[model samples]
Target: MKNILVTGAAGFIGSNLVLELFKEGPYHIIGIDNMNDYYDVSIKEWRLEEIEKNIKKNKWTFIKGNIADKTLIEKIFEEYKPSIVVNLAAQAGVRYSITNPDAYIESNIIGFNNILEACRHSYDDGNNGVEHLIYASSSSVYGSNKKVPYSTDDKVDNPISLYAATKKSNELMAHAYSKLYNIPSTGLRFFTVYGPAGRPDMAYFGFTNKLIKGETIEIFNYGNCKRDFTYIDDIVDGIIRVIKKAPEKKIGGDGLPIPPYALYNIGNSKPENLLDFVSILQEELIRAEVLPSDYDFEAHKKLVPMQAGDVPITYADTSALERDFGFKPSTDLRTGLRKFAEWYKEFYIDGKR
Candidate 1:
């Protein structure tokens, strides 16, 4: 059985990916997460509990530690010797990075460097180690582009937020490592991932909470934004397909290793208008009994100007992903939001199981 190491395993995407990986594998998984209270620590613990319930204790190993800890990360590499490493442990949230920039530097930048160093050393002494290194990138990397459907080929030099800058830095770091040590790396630029048990800091979940509490919810950009909302299941499916395939490690005539690195946009190709998305969310909330049908939806919403670190629109061009993997995220906004609503009712209202 191949050993797989997944960092940030308690996170929304990480936990979902872990559960999906469990469905078809004789593989052993080593999951590590710092469990920082960026949003709510209880939710992270709840995700871990769910993972514990599904897989056998022996088949999976859980490590509650920070990836920025170089000694600890190196020890994990030595002990586990994972053939596949998926780095998802990064400080999330574009807005949070504005106020708490140090957190992003320590976690996203330092933590990623530790992962790269560990992967570099894993190949010591002719060891067939770390066949694939997959890390998470963000749609925020495409900052304030006038173009619709952002592609991987588009130049992403201009980043509006520190979070976007760090994500772009990760791609450059991976490229350097790939060229130096022949590491096969694939970076996935996710576009507005939302689903059941998602990040509470996100708009959909926060909007649900605010609407239920009888509070006014601020709609940024005067509800004139657009987002390519991708479902959690579709994200997991893309990650799984990417994990099985590694980039072709080739060499050039000048004795330099042609970096076996690739990047893809994993997102629902359709970008929905912000106003239309809120409408669908409101309908789902009422359908799931999280909000009353007669609730004054018009009064609770307050449209405001765009925030400092947020973009007006995010549209993904997944043509390259489709051509390479023969897959595309097809989950509609309403269906995905419906599932999130049902999950919210089950988790927050019905005693949370």
Candidate 2:
């Protein structure tokens, strides 16, 4: 069985990916996270509980700690000797980064550096160690670009938020390490990932919470913003495909670096308007009994100007993802949101109480 170390395994995407990985076969998993109260520790803990319930034999090990802890990360690498490492643990949220810039610097930047260093030194035993290193990048990197579908080849030099800056920095760091140490790494620029057990700070979940509480929900950019909302299952599938196939070395004439390293945008090609997305979500919530059937969504939604570090739109050009993996996120908004509503009712409404 392959040994895989997945950081942020208790997170929405990470937890879902762990469940999927377990289904593939018996594989030893070293899951690490700080379990910070950034959102709700109970939600993260509940996800772990669900994983444990399924894999009763304990094919997974959980380590509660921060990724920025260099000694801890290095020790885990030395002991587990993980062949594949997926770094998804980072200080998430674009708006939060504005007030808590220190968090981003410490977790995203410093923590990422630690992960790279550990991966580099893992080969000290004179073995072909760490065949692949996959980490999370965000669509926020293409901040305020006038382009319709943001392509991976587009110049992403301008980042409007600290979160975007940190993500872009991760790409640059990975490139330098890949060039210097010949460690095959891939960075996935996920586009607005959402679905069952999604982050509460995200628009969909936040809006749902306010709508249920009979509170006015703020609609940024006067509800004109668009987003390429990708589903969790699709993101996990794309990760799995890319993990198995690392990038090929580009020769001198190609204008690309030598060695196996690549970056791809995993997203739904279709960009939906913010207003339409909320409407669909409202419908799903009402259908799932999370909200009253007669709930007045129009009265509860308040249109407002864009907030600081907010982008107008985000659309992904998944041509590279399709050309290479022959797969793309195809789940429609209604379908994905329906699953999310069901999960919210079961977990928060029924199970938690």
Candidate 3:
């Protein structure tokens, strides 16, 4: 059985991906996460528990550690010798980066470098190691570009936020390592991912929490922002498809490797207005009986100017993804939010009762 290593395995995307992978077949899966208090440790723990329940003994292993720890990462690589390394671990937040830039550097930069170095060393002793390395990148790297439906072919040199800069750095570093070591790698530029058990810091999850407490939820950019909100399942599906196929390593005219690197923008092509998104979410919440039928959503909403590090819109031109993978995110907002609202009720409301 080929070993697969997934970092940040307790996170929203990480956890979901792990769970879905188990369904694919019997393969040894190793997951590691720091379980930090960035949002709520309880949610991470809950995700871990869910993964544990479906895990077959000896087929799965979980480790509690930070990817920023160089020694720890090297130790894992040496011990597991993973055939596929999916580095999903990173400090994820836009506004949080403003307050804590150190976290971004520590995890996004240093930690990723550690992973790359490990992959580079995997073939030191003529070993067929690390067939593919897939890591998470963000659409935030696009910054406040005037382009609609952001494409991978566009030049992304200017980054508005430190968080975006770090993500862009990850891509550059990965490209260099891929060229130098001929390591097959693919970077996924994910747009706004949302679903049940997602991060509490996300707009949908945060709005739900505040509405339950009768607190006003702030709508940024006066609800003028548009986001390509990709559902968790769709994102996971795209990843699984990519995992089965590694970027082909080829020889250049100069007798050198052609990097064997690839990047793709994975998201729902349709972008939804923030106001429209909120309305659908509220409708789903009420439909799920999480809120009352007569709830005053208007009174509980406060439209505000754009915050720093936030983009006005994020639309994905997923033509490349469809052309390559024959798949694009198709989950509509109502369907996705419905699942989230029901899960929220069961997790927070019904469980507490």
User: Which pairs clash inside model 1?
Assistant: none
The segments of candidate 3 whose C-alpha lies over 4 angstroms from its true place after superposition are 56-58
- Winner on TM-score (2 vs 3): 3
lDDT tens digits, residue span 1-353, model 1:
88999999999999998888888776799999999999888889888989888885337899999999999999999999999999999999999999999999998899999999999999999999899999999999999988888999999999999999999999999999999999999999999999999999999999999999999999999999999999999999999999999999998998889999999999998888988999999999999999998999999999999999899999999998889888777788899999999989988899563
Query: What is the Cα-based lDDT of residue 309 in candidate 2?
Result: 88
Between candidates 1 and 2, the TM-score winner: 1
Give lDDT tens digits, candidate 2, residues 1-353. Answer: 77899999999888988888887757888999899999978889888987887774437989999999999999999889999999999999999998889999999999999999999998886977898999999999998889879998988999999999999999999999998777899999999999988899999999988887899999999999998899999999999888789776555566655867899999998889999999899999999999989998889989999998888889999999999998767788899999999999998788864
lDDT of 2 at 55: 72
What TM-score, computed on C-alpha atoms, does each candidate reach? 0.98, 0.96, 0.98
Model 2 alpha-carbon drift over 4 Å, by segment: 56-58, 249-257
Please state the error at residue 274 of candidate 3 in Å.
0.5
- Candidates' lDDT values, in order? 0.94, 0.90, 0.94
* Sort by lDDT, top down from the best: 3, 1, 2
Error of 1 at 47 (Å): 1.1
* Superposition error at 118 for model 3 (Å): 0.4
Off-target runs (Cα >4 Å) in candidate 1 are 56-58
